[model samples]
Target: MTRPDPADLHPWIAGYLTPYTGRTRQNATQYLRRWETWCGQRGTSIEDATRTDIEAWRAHLSARGVRARGIGAALSPVRGLYLWAAQSYLITHDPAHLVRMPRRPTRSQRPWLDRHQLRRLLDYVDHAGDPAMRAAVHLWSLCGLRPAEPRQLLISDLGTYEGRMSIGLSYRKAGGADRLTVSPPVEAAIRAAVAGRGRGPVLYNENTGTALSKAIARLRLIRILDAARVPHVTPYGLRAGFITLSLEAGVPERDVMYAAGHSSSAQTAYYDRMRHTIRARAVHELTDWLDLTGTPGVTPMSDVPATLPP
Candidate 1:
């Protein structure tokens, strides 16, 4: 079916997406427009959309081989719309209020460098990498930044938070910003990259005074890894390296979760390869309350007077 103009169907889309940032707003607009096209086909206005109409639309998307995650992403805006409409007094009933997003399929643990391999990669970059590449690598590998983060960071994002060196990032997976404490290596790399400049891209060319393109950053990393004789994984692997290695080095998982900007422990665990390997049983914790001393002060369950107490 030909796509219809989203605005003709829903004039409120622009206002609804204002809270989202960057590509998020763009993607949400796209999702809602597709939904509007679907609504046009069924001759149902969004204001008059019923729960059954939403479910049928979900089924339609599913029939076309859209995965659960894609379906969920497409539907997210509709849920937001009803809430917005109800609060704005545009609709009395929320058709999407009870509609549940499809559960995402379980993700396999992603690739990451082990400590020794990562050290070698870092060493190579430090010795031969251009200033921009070195800083990007350190931010991703040491500070657990997303691939886009090191590329997009500004010099002003660096600051002192609670007496610790902090890197403030505005581009996060969930939206908003995060201020992560930096490791010494990350601090040194960032300082060197942004030296003598008050406010500009953190990863910029010395001669050009312009930010390094994503291609340049990625290409350099691949070459550096190859020269260092390390397994070549995508830039995301560098962040996974940070999380996996941090947990292995005895940094608490909860702390890693916060630093990595994960919404839940499960998201952090998905990036982990070391910690979940079972060294001890969780069932062992059940025995923590056990008094195995056989002291007479603790009555045996067989001799308990439960009936009398009642």
Candidate 2:
């Protein structure tokens, strides 16, 4: 039998999810559909699903060996729907509010590659002749970009600010434009990857001529790590190392946060153990090791502004 239309059951879901953007909106849509399916299978309507009903569903999922993270992922959207409905005055009482997620198991801190290991990865990509791969390595391994950050970039995002190449980015989470002044190697690699395309993802597959996927990128990185005898690390590990190493090297906490795309100091503070990590130099001090090939943060050309220092 086909599932019933969710709009027929409740008309508020669309309005409730309207504020979410990108992958967040997609995931919410999927989770709500699953909730609707579960309600239909149990002969209950979403409008009438009580806290008890949600608890029962959680119990059922747990019985089937679903992990806490998986269960939480399924429940959050449903809970959000109820909260929205109540706030909008569409529902007099909110259900699913009291249903708590099962506690997740704690995992150890993620490991990261040192500068030497990262250099090896960079060297590997340099010889690979895939401009997209080269740009990806530079952004993530050197610039400390989260995996999603570079994946969402468009070719148009790369441009010159004050005679130096820079990337203009709008954060998906924070929703602000963060323009990063790049070093010579970063500028060169990004331009080569863009390859005169007016628009498209920054990380593209030359072989397939499509946007490079995060999974494929991770798989490629893992292969390099294995060959180089480096420990496996997630994209977050690369970011962690960037933050940790920069802080240890005495790059000011403020500059470190700015470079890492962190909106607040609290976010940057979580990466290191020290309360204070300021030193004599600015951001360029930390990035100078990259061999910027010009005075750090100095404009090669005249007549433009630096949005944020390198």
TM-score of each: 0.72, 0.73
lDDT of 2 by residue, 200-243 (tens): 89888776778898788888777766765777888888777778
Which residue window of length 10 is worst by lDDT in model 2?
273-282
lDDT of each: 0.81, 0.76
Where model 1 places Cα greater than 4 Å from the true spot, the runs are 1-9, 18-24, 41-44, 48-66, 86-89, 97-99, 106-109, 160-165, 170-178, 195-198, 206-208, 278-310
lDDT of 2: 0.76
